[model samples]
Target: MKINVKLFATFRIGRGKIVYLDYYEGMTVKNIIDELGIKKEEIAIIIVGPHDGTPEKMLTFKVEPNMTVHLFPPVAGG
Candidate 1:
């Protein structure tokens, strides 16, 4: 299966803004993060299956093919 990943904020510093990758069935958000060499703490939030509904939890959410997964880094401001 293939999925489209979008990176934002700090997560996009080194990596590009978007990428297309291959994944197997039952692949969780953690699996993608691990594959990208991103530490769990590095990502503040993840949204799967478009921008509707709730964001998927990193550890337990299985990513489906053809879905758009957006990764965001921690937001800090005064």
Candidate 2:
């Protein structure tokens, strides 16, 4: 299975804005984040398809083929 991943904010430092990952049957969003070397604490928002991904969901949400996952890091400064 292939999953599309989009990185936003500071999450795109070394990695590009969009990436396609080869995922397994039981792969979760957390697995993708770990493969990209991103810390869970650094992610502020996650959008899996049309749903707002919560922290618990990120850990347990199963990634389906062709699903698009967006990851955003926390932003500061007012």
Clashes of each: 0, 0
For candidate 2, the TM-score is 0.91
Clashing pairs in model 1, backbone N/Cα/C closer than 3 A: none
Residue-by-residue lDDT tens digits, candidate 2, 1-78: 789999997888989999899978999998999999988888888899778765666767888999999998878889
Each candidate: RMSD? 2.6, 1.2
Tens-place lDDT per residue, model 1, 1-78, is: 688889997777777898778979888777877777788777677888653222345556878888878888777888
* Most lDDT-accurate candidate: 2
| Winner by TM-score | 2
